[model samples]
Target: MQEKIIDDKILEHMTLENVFKIINDNIFPLLNEKEKDFCRELQEFCIELHPKIDKNQDVYVLFPELGKRGYMQRINLWRDFMPYGMKSEILLATHLSCLDSQLELARLASGILCGNPTFQHGETDEILKVQDELMEGSKIGCIGITEPNRGSDAVNMTSTCRKSDDGSHVIYNAEKVFTTNGPKADYFATYAVYNQANPRGTMVQAMVSRDFKGQLITNRLKIPYVDRVHIAHTIMNEVEIPVNYILGDNGKGYTNLFDGLVPERLGIMGSGLGICWATLAYAIIYTNLRQQFGQNIINFQGVGFSLGDLLARTSSATALAFQAATSYDDNILFAEHPSKEAEKWIAGVSSQGKYLVSKLSADLTYTVQQQMGGISVTDNTDVQELSSTSYIEEVIGGARNIQLLIIQNALRRYSKLILS
Candidate 1:
């Protein structure tokens, strides 16, 4: 006996192409003409590339492909890519996540996590060269901030660095866990403190290159779900970095670290947005076609109402993400003298938005899975993969509690604003 095949039209409608159609219907109305065009190009590119990916292999192999299309990142001006800004970066993340969440994770680590610092703070020729390499995807990058014991307390780093006698070099002896893309990274945006007791005044950020002489060790972490994207535990012993490689020197590293967080959280929100949209779109299509009791499951009140509720929440979260991205672009990215007040407001709202959307991604995917039933767990669809990745959404960028803590501190500051 042979397995029965599903109808060709049903198979075609379930593809990423159809997913793009659903995504455009929901999201294009909110975008400007240029933004819509960018999304369309990304959609077409994703459609063409999706069939070529070997899911079992490392996603790093595809970096150059993204680089060729100027898709590695969009937060800052890379070359001649138009409409470059925070919103564009968010859109890039959204489409990339929809294409492959695992690849999006690695791309974020290499492009935004490492490349962003260079664009924001770099001045020297060497650092600019590093930027070009990263943007061009000739090299891979990762950030080292999290450690074995120091996770949430990022400011209080256990990793230590020292200045050489000539002051031309910074030496690091550090251990970093959860170093996404570390196993294959050519450039590392690593942070350390010269004085742990005075980290705020003595922290340093360096762009550590693999070609540099040092005992740099990276072992792939056992993150089974996102195996397509490497994560590692990296140990650096006396990694000597030239002063020119430093993106943030002395106390400036503290400020740079926090500055990077806003965009990082926003990027995560965009990825979460894609997860929400992709999973919901898949469920909508699946339920409408799957029949029970001689009728489509989507027509049943239970399935229909639940999906409707998820869609409403997903749309609301997307609006919040776009609103935040737009504000950041207008005030920070494009402003001659960026508004301090808007910066403060956006910093707080980033936490709020990240918190809401990350959790929503998980909830929406899980609920969609339940509404979708057993087929969702199979390889025939993307729902399970989305759900698996969504499970980690609340924990990355900053964990759920961390986002809440930031929001809580902001809430406490409201009294001061009220009195002033």
Candidate 2:
């Protein structure tokens, strides 16, 4: 066989159409007709958009396209997009992640991380304008909660803030790290504290625009895996934000910060779940076609069984993510009167699901790479890219240890309920 023919034979299975077909075949049964239609629409969009992407360019370049389609964020009703809720958001994240994990990461940061605060806490015209800009992708956004000294200890932040005498402006002096999309963001949904000793009592959450007439500086951090996605080391020196831009001030910032994390983690779960499915789908396609010892490699007991194990685990994680999203939608996002009990339950479950799925994304990608061999490691296939994304999954949206800590804290609480 000619080399061209051979290359075509192996590469054909890795096409977006085939991969989407596989994922759709597996998961569509779980979705209703409308949800399935949404998936198909995403599939078509991804299929069309995938080929045009410049791998070296910034992911933000695609933000306008996402905004046009209401793909920037799906959790809230932005424009006329239907089925706007947590589950829809999850599906959107999943499809985007499968299409391009880096783009999805940047979108989540801009759309959900930054834009979400506006929806959740913003009550002023100024903040709403920023929200519209972010959702429309006319302006990019990022969150600045994680600081140099505070990774998992997010609430007790050292970044300081001061309110003006007239109370019309809040000044922030903060150095934040691990800020995804920060370098290119036009607005920052950032946090700071008035008193370090009383962070919870004095924290402030504000939407700081890049042109806010303050020294809001950002330098891109070298996260080599998702080079298209910009993570930043942000330094805010006397950045003065108008009081109206403050989403949460005083002790309310602490509450708002924690409130945002549940959905943020759930969104990450959606992204990780996509990585799992994409890795599995691509590996499955490649293994079933690549020949070894005069037989397709997938027929071998070792490869087949390993794929089986990954399949089962990915399906279970998908179920967990979908269920959590559904419950969140029912009890929180779309709730007329949100159920406190369900809220409490979903919070714990989000931590648990985030922990499981994030680790699973890393593990399964590596395992599937091993199963698919050299082609997977090369750009000839997407396994290597998926693996790159997986490596960061455990670290983002709070590290694996933080998720475990949340789960453990929830476990400790069970003692009181059961004992009572």
Candidate 3:
């Protein structure tokens, strides 16, 4: 049998063209439509503009729109163009092309935060970038560390990577749960504990492409709305990939995970800020337009006071999210971890900001829904959608409890500084 060879340009074009089309036609149109609808609804409801909320909502609806708009043709261009950009000069200089440039990666992360299915939708690009070899029409890459059994504890992974004597390949066996983009990913950045030497030694990061035999199992996760976010699971049954497919050094996968998580946390915080802004905007409009006792509700001291409190919270949350983003952007330049002291402070602040905004969004959304009275419960009502989304924001990308734990951990590290 003749070995099949993959053409780089063909792969690149297939990836980039599809993504570009998806974004320009599907994502952008839906964004514009939603923006117009949301703005008009707010105006009719007499609400103020909330950029963060607007951006987040735009992201949530972008996935289906990409499918609808047939823009998958040019989706991979950003991934290809990004690594060579000025921001990623250092990474590009190293001749690394497996992962995207930092800016491109950031853009992709941002798209995901906004609920765009760039990861799933741009699978072709993912494969071209991450995998060394590719087969035609292959799906893109995915990250599948999280599981139904082990949530945050990556060390407790049940997956195992066993090396063969030939040293040509490694066999991977594990069941991964809660995989985002699992169903569609052609390749996977999979984390598994290698048990060849000793079962309790260290974890290894391997690149497992879909060409290797594996099963994508869909477990329907119930959310409040049909248009809610999507997540999935993947079962790897003795999947095989080249021995060279390992990422970083063996046993250092956790470090990579930690480094990656900092940015992920910041990204989630940004989305939360957006949700908070949206909630406050909704509350402001509802309080003004709603009438009780023959006068607008805003005229009532109680209603005005509640809205004022939410506005104050929104402002504080915005400031915190901004500060955290700034810190993260700056830290990207530092080769080492920002001073442990600084890291602790920033982590604490970011966690607090995320939690505060999440809570405020939830409270404000509820208050606004109540102010809207009977209409708030209906699916057609804008307030209902806004309220439901607020809850989604609270749970997605690490919940309030998780943020609190992060804050507590950071605070523990800073205890001596405070005492001094």
Query: Across residues 372-401, which tens digit of lDDT does each residue of candidate 3 receive?
Result: 566456532244555555565565456678
Q: Residue 200 error for model 1, in Å?
A: 0.7
lDDT of 1: 0.89
Q: Which ten residues in a row have the lowest lDDT in candidate 2?
A: 1-10
Compute the lDDT for candidate 3. Answer: 0.47
- Candidate 3: worst-modelled 10 consecutive residues by lDDT: 93-102
By the lDDT metric, which is better: model 2 or model 3?
Answer: 2
lDDT (C-alpha, whole model) for all candidates:
0.89, 0.90, 0.47
Candidate 1 residue 320 Cα shift, in angstroms, is: 0.8
138-207 per-residue lDDT for model 1 (tens digits): 8999999999999999989989999999998999999999999999999999999999999899989999
Candidate 2 clash pair list: none
